[model samples]
Structure formats: structure tokens, C-alpha cells
Target: GESVGLHLPTLSVQEGDNSIINCAYSNSASDYFIWYKQESGKGPQFIIDIRSNMDKRQGQRVTVLLNKTVKHLSLQIAATQPGDSAVYFCAENMRGAGSYQLTFGKGTKLSVIP
Candidate 1:
């Protein structure tokens, strides 16, 4: 069995500060990794993706770093904002024999103290 958990249920930060969201993944054999941002009542939006072959990837205002040795992952946001307050989840894609499925972490809630 595999699972993901957040170290904290909620994080409060100032509007101009940077934010780091952490996730713990259970399955090390997973090939693809994705970070998603979910706004209230909305579907998760793709933030960035990285393959097992790569250690890090970056996108507009966001960066994702993966550490395979420790089975850990993290998301970095450049500037915190009120709009950036939301729940973020990490998903791992398990690929085998042409089959794939995404397993999502529980998620961490970000709260901006604007």
C-alpha cells in the first residue's frame, strides 16, 4: 500500500513571501510526477511535471524538486498572494506494461495572511 501525507494541515504566510509545500510519497517505483493546484470547487490544475530521470523542473512562478533517494517531493512558489491560497496536491504516475494511473497525495492547504 502507498500513501502521501502533508506535514501540516495549513500554512499561513504573508502575501509577499515565498511558500514551500511539502509532500511525502510512498511508492518509489513511480515514473512520472506532477504537482497540481486546486482552487475552491475547481479541478486540479497542472503546475509542473517531472520524470523519474530528472530531478527538477520549473514553470512560471513555480518550481518542483524531487528527491528519489528519500522518496520526498516539494513545491516552491515565488511570491505568495491571496489568490495563491489553495490546496495543493502531488500526484505520482505508476507506469507498467503500457498501463498508468495517478495516485494523489492528501494535500496541504495554503493560507495567505493578506
Candidate 2:
């Protein structure tokens, strides 16, 4: 149930503004979270990550906030740009039964209008 599919394929944004992308995760036991950015027709690249033990994690131009109590996560982009336009995916990793696997939430499309 953690698998994600976008309702829209594209999002247009102005070049110099902040962007917030949303994703919904299914597993309540997931302990690790990661955010990835994927450009048009490209593989997803790691943006940032947060563990269940922490509530927030930040990167150079990005920040990931996790609310384990509600099973919610969010990614914030400082400045929007044409190069920043891409699809964003949130993934969760659950550790149990002596094994771990990543479950990806449906992605949101981000488009920056330059």
C-alpha cells in the first residue's frame, strides 16, 4: 500500500519560489524515510533522508520533515528553478523479521516555469 502513483503528470512553478511536494505512505512500521528527485526520463536521485528517531533532516537546498505520529512526510525546496523541476518520490524502509525493504509512495510532479 506504500506504492505511489501521481494524479497529475506535471506541475508548473515560477523560477524563484519555494515548492512543497507531498506523498502518502502506507506502512505504519516503516522506520526510515528518503526523498528522491527524478528529472524527465531519468533515474531518481537521493535528495535527503530522515530516520524514525528524528523529526527533521536538512540538506543544502532541501529539507525533509517527518511526522511519525501521523505517518506523514514532506519535502521542501528552497528555491524553484527550471532545473529543479522534476518528479519527487518519498520512500519508506521498514525493518522487521530480520529484513528490510524500501516502499515508495506515489510521486508528485514538479514543474518549474522559467
Candidate 3:
């Protein structure tokens, strides 16, 4: 079963350094995953995502890794910047024919230190 606040925390990084964010999900049946970045008072912005069929996926300056064995996922950011400081979140969605909803994990707030 998917619920809320599985483990949303915070992550801090220095400017120009690489950052790694992690998430653990409860639904093994979930096949779709997405990562989002939410700044203060702003809507969430899509970062990256991965499917159950793939173990790893990458985007511009970002990487997503999935470990179904442990039901864990991780996000890697290359050269973290001050603008990257925000609350990072992970969302999981199950595969179905009908309508489906997203189960968002606890957000990790990344504080970029200059």
C-alpha cells in the first residue's frame, strides 16, 4: 500500500558540488516514478523520472536510479547550484488502464551553501 510521508526529509549541498537525494517507496507494484523540485511559494517543477522496466535513467545534469529489490530510489544532481535549493520530491504511480493517482514520498529540501 502507498501512503504519505514514507521518508521525506532534507538534503544540503554546496554550490558547484554534486548532490544525491534518496527515496523509499512502499508499492512494489508501482511502475512509474517521477521527481519534482518545489521552490518556496512556487509550483513543483519536474526534474526526472524512471520506469519499472529501467533500473536507471538520466537527464540534463540529473540521474534517477531505481532499486526495486529494496523499493528504493535515488536522484543525483551534478554541480548543484544555489538556484537548485528547493524541496525535492519523488512520486510513484502504478500502471493501469483507468485513471490513477500519484503517491508522493517525503520531500527532501536541498539547501545550497555558497
lDDT of 1 by residue, 1-114 (tens): 122334648888899999999888888899889999887777888889989899888888898999999988999998888999888999998776788889998899898998
Clashes within 3 Å, all models in order: 0, 3, 1
Rank order by lDDT, top first? 3, 1, 2
Clashing pairs in 3: 8-106
Question: Compared to the true structure, candidate 3 yields what TM-score?
Answer: 0.88
Assess the local accuracy of residue 14 in candidate 1 as a C-alpha lDDT between 0 and 100: 95
The best candidate in terms of lDDT: 3
Candidate 1 local Cα displacement, residue 19, angstroms: 0.4
For model 1, give the 10-residue run with minimal summed lDDT: 1-10
Q: Looking at candidate 1, what is the lDDT of residue 73?
A: 90
Which tens-of-lDDT digit does each residue in 1-114 have in candidate 2?
122344755567799989888666788888899998877667889999999899888898888888877789988898887888777889999777998888886688887888
- Candidate 2, residue 76: CA error in Å? 0.2
lDDT of 1: 0.86
Which 10-residue span in candidate 2 carries the lowest summed lDDT?
Answer: 1-10
Compose the digit string of candidate 3's lDDT tens values, residues 1-114. 222233547677889999999999989999999999988778789998899999999899999999999999999999999999888889999656786988887689888999
